[model samples]
Target: MPTSRSSSSIWTYLFLLGEPEQQQRFFKELHFISIVTLSFGVASWLVTVALMQHRHALDTQSASLALVGMVAGVTITALGKSLLAIVVSGSASVLFVTYGFQVLIAATDDPSFWVLPLGVLITLTIAPLFSGIAWYLAVSLCVWVMLGWEQFPAHPQQADQYWPMLAVVVSMLIGLSLNVYFLVLRIHNYQAQRELATMAYTDSLTGLNNRRRFTQSARQLHRSALAPAYFLMIDIDDFKQINDEHGHDVGDEVLRKTAEVIAGIAGEHLCGRLGGEEFAVIYQGDKHGACLLATQLIETVEAAFAGERKVSISIGVAELVKGTDLAHSYRRADASLYLAKKNGKNRYELAAS
Candidate 1:
């Protein structure tokens, strides 16, 4: 079976690229760490090559030249660090194979003439199949080319040359795969959190903002310089009597139907269920708008409930004052609502100053 590594690699790439703002901090941290690690690898490789030359008493000029090339490569990578990390890590495998083949060629007289042909065939085959696979092939190919196939001596220790190349290829693949996996996991968690937040703020029964969300929205509106808005609290008249006379099931149906009637009349106004038998609306306009909406709501509910067990509702409207909070607005509306019930059931009242 093909490994989970490939699947994980795909997920990681998508996570990093998806929801730019949501994952921006993670991306930034990943970029910084990648750059630091890549720099260290390049530095260590150059140091190792220099030490080997010194120990073997080989020509210092060759080692010095190699060190310069390594430094230049490191500098190029650091300058465009993010892009280079992706490019290098993604293509590590292909580079290893390609440079490994060149080394093999240098060590043998008639290095398999098929090496180039086979490498090309493999590169072409994998590149179109999967991004990570294509990248691995490309990196391996680059590594083979860099190993200098022309200089591979006849009596070489095949194990030494091949093992280091294999190690580099494996390490790069592992790192890339792990990075992508964790990134995808983070994205999934973020989506779940967003869904939970939405549920918390929304009323499932009415499909409106619940009391909690209404308070939050009111605070937002209070900060704006818009026209004075109104808060209207409404309660079904003798709702407990309805539940007692008719079954609670009928009472629930009545409540649902009443919510629909109020929502239809409220139109663009924000409406929500504050609690049992009580609903609230926030209208972003003058008192006239609130009065019109209240009248419409009263008419709609009366019409809808005319023959359905003779139900009725009381409404109270309060205009938002400058420098007032949601609690105060709610209190005002509630006071008006109490007056409407006291004066007569099935009526509307505006809060008195």
Candidate 2:
């Protein structure tokens, strides 16, 4: 059962790193990755101990410290906590390297000497692979250096095997530094992708949700069985004449102001520009509520563009029927919109309840 629980925890933790969210979320993603690597590092530490001639290879104090760090790191990671996990995991890394190096120093003349340099290289490489969290790497490197200084060869000629270890450290440092640099670049690229996605769903002229966004939101609301809602199709009355007479610039300003009025009226409701001089809105309201909103929208647009542009809106509204999809509801609203235009523009026509 313990094994099963541990496996479940690990898988759950692993799945949480789906994607980097906002800027702060990037740090959380880094923490998650660090947590996973720390777990494997601890596991490697234990595996090395188990492959030894003596089960009690580590001193009682040091062993206790390592176990505390490893277990605490794992527990905090399981709880989705990070700061304490960072601290404990750093300490665990130190103990793993230091204790392993101590054993290596003692067995320098034995066949185990072949494994010592490899262990040191692995420790140095993995510790700083997490570039953003420097405290852990600093603490681990300091512990390893302080504990193993005496283990270094006292004479230059005796340091032949040690040069390869230094070479490994240097190579790993260069490669890890490049990896960190690229990660920063990746974050910037992710930010760009986010901006591009926003642009794709946004109307460039009116700064409103584009048709694509409206379709997505409307479909979602319909599929979720949300009743007591209304869909509205709005068209600017005499828009083509205004553009043809007043020029495109004035026409653009009129569209912008009209969109502002609609957006303000539909606060927290979905409002999107369907295309040139046409828009759509979805609100969680009944026929009466939608009528009130449509009235306010018509009055506000008339008043807003009264002096300069002098424009009004024609709106068609339909209360969503149960089991009707967004496309059907929108089409019903569109039919009403045509009736509104036919009834001498600057007014609203409601679809039969």
- Structural similarity to truth (TM-score) of each candidate: 0.57, 0.69
Which 10-residue span in candidate 1 carries the lowest summed lDDT? 124-133
| Candidate 2 weakest lDDT stretch, 10 residues | 11-20
Report lDDT per candidate. 0.63, 0.69
Per-residue accuracy of model 1 over 222-251 as CA lDDT, tens digit each: 778378888889999999998998988888
Model 2, range 16-127, lDDT digits (tens) per residue?
3213253344445556666566677667667876676655544656565656666665556546454344445545554554555454345434433443355455555454
lDDT of 1 at 276: 82
